[model samples]
Target: MSADETPQGYSIFRDTMADMTFPEIARAAERRAVVLWGLGVIEQHGPHLPLGTDVYMPSELLRRVRRLLAERGIDSVIMPPFYWGVNQVSGAFPGTFVVRPEIVIELIVDLIKSLKKDSFARLFCISGHGDALHNRTVHAGIARGADEAAIAAYFVGAPSFFARVGIAADDPHILPTHSEVERPSRYFDVHAGKFETSSMWAAYPGLVRDELLPALRSTDFGVEDISEWRKGGDHARAKTPQGYLGDPAASDREFGETMMAQHAELVAAAIAAQVGAAR
Candidate 1:
């Protein structure tokens, strides 16, 4: 299904916790339905894409994943999109809102506590941002939340994040790596490049500045450049002057759609496995 088309009988107001009344949410919790949360960051994705790119992508993925879950007879509820995420790498950008890692951790822990209080036993966090520190912080938050609240919670994100944070590849909470779903431009599509630009084009076309795409050039960011970019602030800006890493001009809606679909499938499968194991 296209981004513009909603599945028949699918209602956001009915599926999301934010839109439901206290009694409805209590009933969902009693049913032991998994709670889904999209973890996003308000960061710059070049001039062509909106600052909410991270939020929109994960929220869209969660929507698709929720449908897939329902098709499998698994019930789930979505929380409102959480966009106040750590943005260390893109802090130099004008629109990026960088928060302390501890703040994210505390907020997540509190969220889990509140859910646990409501009798919710499971939670799944899906993030669109790929910054190493951000992912690590989120993982830490989930870990802490599970321990403190005695709830089963998982963080789903890029497989590389596990290795970056010293988690084993086989870690149950981390989504297993799927080579089949890997992007063709994974090497260079680090930031608001062809990969993300194409994604926004497919998922939120109106938010993308299509006219600016033609003039945007691609930057061949090498390992050394990435090392500098990781420093963030001035160092990152020096490496990516225009605030993007890859070729935005090469973006294609079809590519974005395929990528999103494949990723949603992987996420749904992972969530299903985790839910079963928890049960």
Candidate 2:
């Protein structure tokens, strides 16, 4: 990927994966390179947002991160966003496309195998879809593959790397005016709320239904599964009928820009730091 080109002008993630020669990939891996794979879901986001909110936001963020990583001289590739994920809560909702946990795990494991076989030293699963079940799958898949497949290779989550960057050390509320996130903001309203909405605005403004955002509100809420008015398990439709748990009115684009930049910088820096350490 060339820096002279804008993020919008950038080609497919598959192109990056296919760009390098086997020998070149091996040499880079021997020297400790990092490859980033974005994880997200194609699920319902309320009336105000598109189904691909998770994928769209992270695609833009990862693009910015790719540039930052390049500036730090890190040999990194941002894989295409992985949309097939376990969206248990949203499954009963009309637009949500949910996958079983084990299926997600197996796919991640296969990806790890492919990257390792091609000589990528470290694999960073940078997820935008933050479901507990999905997170567990990605973490476990990486752990299992790195342990049994490639002993010297590294596989881990982008969150842990963000922790190393320090901003996400304790769930800070990220500021919209600047990169300063308030303490414990990360812990608050993580589901399809302001963060997701404003993020949709920042990355793909045309896709967001701004006028409809005012009408979308849900007072009844429970962080735990409340079943989408369905049998056995609770879902997004139950706790958040509109499929959003945060304040859509508060999804400030200014804050979103700051948040995306902060995330990109932290992710890039963390990868560079870890690659340096591994070397």
Candidate 3:
């Protein structure tokens, strides 16, 4: 689908909270509409992709999720994208904007509180960025918000994130995928590799610099290399001088669409289960 085209039955103005008026929002809240919020970061994603890749990817995924929810007879509200997130690993890159972890936590807490004040009870925080610290901070914020505001808040993320924080994959606050999205370059495509490049191409082809793909080589990193890159600053730059990992040339739009669709399926299923159980 093109950027301007909405799905057959989806209406952005009616479903998106940011586009709704106070009365509409109040009505949605009365109907127990679930809120879907996309969390991302402004960071470099190699030479070929735009810096807003993180924001764009999750925003697109959430759009698909919203459509899927509508089809399942579920009411939902999509929040405006939140891209000001912590970017610790890629902070060395020029386009990266690293917010303080405490600030991110505070911002998330405030957002949740505001939603509660507006009578929103259930929130799903879906993030495109996978920085361990960033995920942890967001989780912390959600926890605090749920406790203080008495709202049902969930952090939808990968199993790796839940594992990293020592939280069970099946935790009540977490909606993790059953497994990682299967792809040929799964291991090496850590950063702006084939997976991300293709995803951007499929969703927003105009934003991607396709011409640069042919000339760019892959920067596949092993475990040791990843450890070095995680150090940030000079270490990360030294590990990925070109500011990307994996082979962009290997990206395929079809694979991107498949991967995103699979993810949306998993996320939509999880959301449906929660919504049903609540009823």
Candidate 4:
């Protein structure tokens, strides 16, 4: 677990988990002060990215962060990903697997409780979805649950304590870019937007569609502000109407790599704060 033995230098998820026995894994967890709990969803990420995009991003980020921890002689393990979240928007979409907010809180609380029983002390939840507010609330729920158990918990969000020194709140699109693949232009696609498209292109390039973005129409819910940005707004009809938010016409791999690098750094710094020698 020294500074040079980080999982970032090598791929952990891609590698087999069989290498470490239960005792070995538990031993590693006992020696470490922090555990990263990834929360993602099996919902639509525009047409460009796979339904598993949410799951992949956090795991990838953790891989890099682990590398940094190894550099600092701090060892942390990425817990199994929790793939269910509040996904009301993508309910109309084929692959969307929505979980009620209450369920999210309870299930996460149970997971943390179980982990605490096993000797892990601190927990961090890293999530991605349309429900930022809901996710933050869920984070709070986990923290409260952990507190009841006398453990600490936090969320790795852009504006939270883990903020990267130079990263802007609006820089590098948070969602995907769902349009064309070549020479993509930056469009106002927030849901099925260009940023998401670029990210999907980087992670699962074969899943993206290069044409048919301009024809999409906007799906405005009657509730205006309240319903517009939610998962129920218009997920199934992204290509026909407003299924996505950003324009995916200009997405490319280069932008994806840059975003990944930045995101990984932020994740690493956050994990460092948790696993660094000081704690």
Candidate 5:
């Protein structure tokens, strides 16, 4: 093989993972290893961001994390990303798809079980969906399904990162003066709305609908706290005609890079810890 094509880098995004023979993978297990599986919702991301915002963010971060870990001689692979998720908030917006909470959990369990069957001893789930309670419950289910086949199945994104980034503990936008916020809005939009818009713009520029940005509305009217925000239903505060909560106009690529870099670092560190513990 050519030098460039060699598995010199540890990233699964590279051809190396695809080209890896079963024997190759088994041999590599003698060192240290981990595999990352991603789950993202294909739902509304306000007026400017694409419906695939949630999916794209985790996938992109997994790619970057794979590269980062490779730099440290860590072995990692990013499996195909799951687009199914509990999308309650963006359901009011067109193109949003909601998978029932039970289905999401069951699917995750099956995914983890299969990974364990394949001898992947360490697994992590990365989600960018609306239902916090549901996602955590689902993660627990996946861990249960893994049983003794693996060590643990973890959910990477947590409230701590938002806290660390200085995002206040208020719901970004869930309730408007006229409507009751639903389950989807309460959990997902904590950092949804403009924050998600800016993030998508940073990760995948072409997915953003720039023309819609000007028309998007930025309002604090619907939000009471972070918990009351609606995840679904035809609420008055569900979305502005433009579909964003805060001002996506203020979003820049730099901020997106910063957010993504931090997430990658967290993933890499977690993988390192999990792999070490497995040994």
Candidate 6:
């Protein structure tokens, strides 16, 4: 194998308790081992993206981030994906498995406590789906973590970074509103648009049908909060019947691969920074 393709001696699992030894685990934990958890929604992602699109995208980041951390002697692992995330808007879609918001929060809280009990140095949760309530819940759980564990917890994804790096700033469109302050006008979706389609195409070719781009591409857009979406997935279905909000035709694998690589880079850097800061 080429040097770049070599495997670093790090354990990446859906669950970490089963495969690690006590002494080995202790060595890693002492070195500030960071657990990278991939959180995603089992929801609908238009025609071109797969139903597990949210989880898969962030999992890709976790996978690559493990390799980066391994190279630096910072023990790290990617746990099995936590797919039951908050997908209130996608409830209208057939594939969506919407769970109560509290369910996700509780799951996160329990997992954090479990990891903290295990003596892990830090835990970073990366979610592909952007649910404000979900993010807030995760943050709250992190805040409640004990001082000794001092868990470094937060959410990371492409959309948040896109805005951070001036990509969103260029297009003054506020999603539901082009530009203006409005109540519950807090969310916007390019749905199966560029990011979702491209990332899926890059990671899982079997799961994506690039030929369906014509059917998936559309200019339909909408805005709604978690409460409205909780009413039912039908509302979202009515907003964008195709289950997408942006053009999938322009989603090329090359662009998708490049975007995913950059995303992985950004996420890995963030984890590294958090680990360093925690120390």
TM-score of each: 0.91, 0.76, 0.92, 0.73, 0.74, 0.74
Which ten residues in a row are the worst by lDDT in model 3?
6-15
lDDT of 1: 0.82
Least accurate 10 contiguous residues by lDDT in model 5: 173-182
How many angstroms is residue 241 displaced in model 6 relative to the true structure, after the best TM-score fit? 0.6
lDDT tens digits, residue span 1-279, model 4: 211145443222442223456797688667854676667787776554567777766666666666776777766677777787876556777787877777787887787887788788877666655455456546656766776777766666555312322223442212111221232333334455656666656654545665654454433323343344553636335432434655556566678766666676666665566445345
For model 4, give the 10-residue run with minimal summed lDDT. Answer: 172-181
Query: Alpha-carbon error at 251 in model 4, in Å?
Result: 0.7
User: How do these models rank on TM-score, best leading?
Assistant: 3, 1, 2, 6, 5, 4
- Model 1 misplaced regions, further than 4 Å: 1-15, 170-172, 177-180
lDDT of 3 by residue, 1-279 (tens): 645344532222333577778999899999988999888899998889888888888878888898899899998889887888888788988989989989988888888999999999999988888677877787888888888889999998768768975666666677776666776754567678898888888877878899989988877677888888888888888989988878898888888888889888888888888789888
Q: How accurate is candidate 5 locally (lDDT)?
A: 0.59
Q: What is the C-alpha lDDT profile of model 2 across 11-92, one tens digit per residue? A: 3343355566767767767765676767788888777888877776667777787788778787666666688897755677
Question: Who is ahead in lDDT, 2 or 5?
Answer: 2
Off by over 4 Å in 5: 1-32, 148-151, 159-192, 221-228, 236-241
Model 2: per-residue Cα lDDT at residue 182: 35
Ranked by lDDT, the better of candidates 3 and 4 is 3
lDDT of 5 by residue, 1-279 (tens): 211234453222343345567777676544436777667777666656667677777777787788888887777777777887776655666787877877776777787777666677666666666455445555556556666445455555445533433333343210011111121322233444556665666766666777766655446544353334453465524444445555665566667666677667866776666556556
Candidate 2: Cα lDDT at 165 = 31
Per-candidate clashes, comma-separated: 0, 9, 0, 34, 14, 4
Q: How big is the positional error of residue 96 in model 1, measured in Å on the Cα after superposition?
A: 1.1
Candidates ranked, most accurate by lDDT first: 3, 1, 2, 6, 5, 4
Worst 10 residues of 2 by lDDT: 171-180
For model 5 the TM-score comes to 0.74
